[model samples]
Target: TYIRHDSKDQFTGLLDKNGVEIYEGDIVKDADSGSYGAVVWSNDKHWGYLFDTRPDYGWSHPVKGFQRNYLEVTGNIHETLLEADNAKT
Candidate 1:
């Protein structure tokens, strides 16, 4: 089966602590803070990748500088949300 172009996410040109490529829609965990968030593109003036924790913690940070060092990809939003939904059912 063919997948829609929009269904695919863009790579952020960065890697997780485990050396996995970081991509939009990926759910990453902050080793220092032990918090999780999904990767998303920012539309603000900074205009780059953002580690969005708004859904769970009401805060976010740009995925630049030293922040990428502690990020580890635990899962993607699709599978993460699915697992959450299943847990609620």
Candidate 2:
């Protein structure tokens, strides 16, 4: 299988509260609200780092500094969103 040569090849340097590795495009949900967002690297912080998503609340925040114990890897963005959309119908 051919992989994209994007910078996503770099390590996200993060993991879920369950020790699951966090990666770009991986969808994450807050254990409390069940709010989900895709894992993405933000340039807003200059050099940049992997941040947990919470579109319902706002944008992404550093996983390192946030409450990692409250985060979970539900699925990746594509399949997870597709599943949600399909369920709505």
Candidate 3:
């Protein structure tokens, strides 16, 4: 998912393939998958999405930026699960 800031510097939703919403008012910036989730700014309100399953969120978290899948959205967390499975084995 790619993001672009408007003239006022307010972020806007460009496109979303992951079927996730990141912002409420406007989107400002976003992080790469490695960073975990992306950050969005909306009229002073900010939020983000969790790339992987975390304690904060059951599996994912709610954010203020538009979520994407093809471009730069974060992937689901699998390392933890993999570790657990490996341990069981």
Candidate 2 residues 1-89, lDDT tens each?
11222454444667678887666777677787767766676656421223344445556655653666887766665566677999999
Worst 10 residues of 3 by lDDT: 20-29
Candidate 3 lDDT by residue in tens digits, 22-88: 3323222244434444343323344444344345652334442334443343322233345579999
**lDDT, model 2, position 54:** 49
Error of 2 at 66 (Å): 4.5
Order the candidates by TM-score, highest first — what do you get?
1, 2, 3
Query: What TM-score do all the candidates reach, one by one?
Result: 0.68, 0.57, 0.23
User: What's the lDDT for candidate 2?
Assistant: 0.61
Question: In angstroms, how far off is 84's CA in candidate 1?
Answer: 4.5
Total backbone clashes of model 2?
A: 0
Per-model C-alpha lDDT, please?
0.69, 0.61, 0.39
lDDT of 3: 0.39
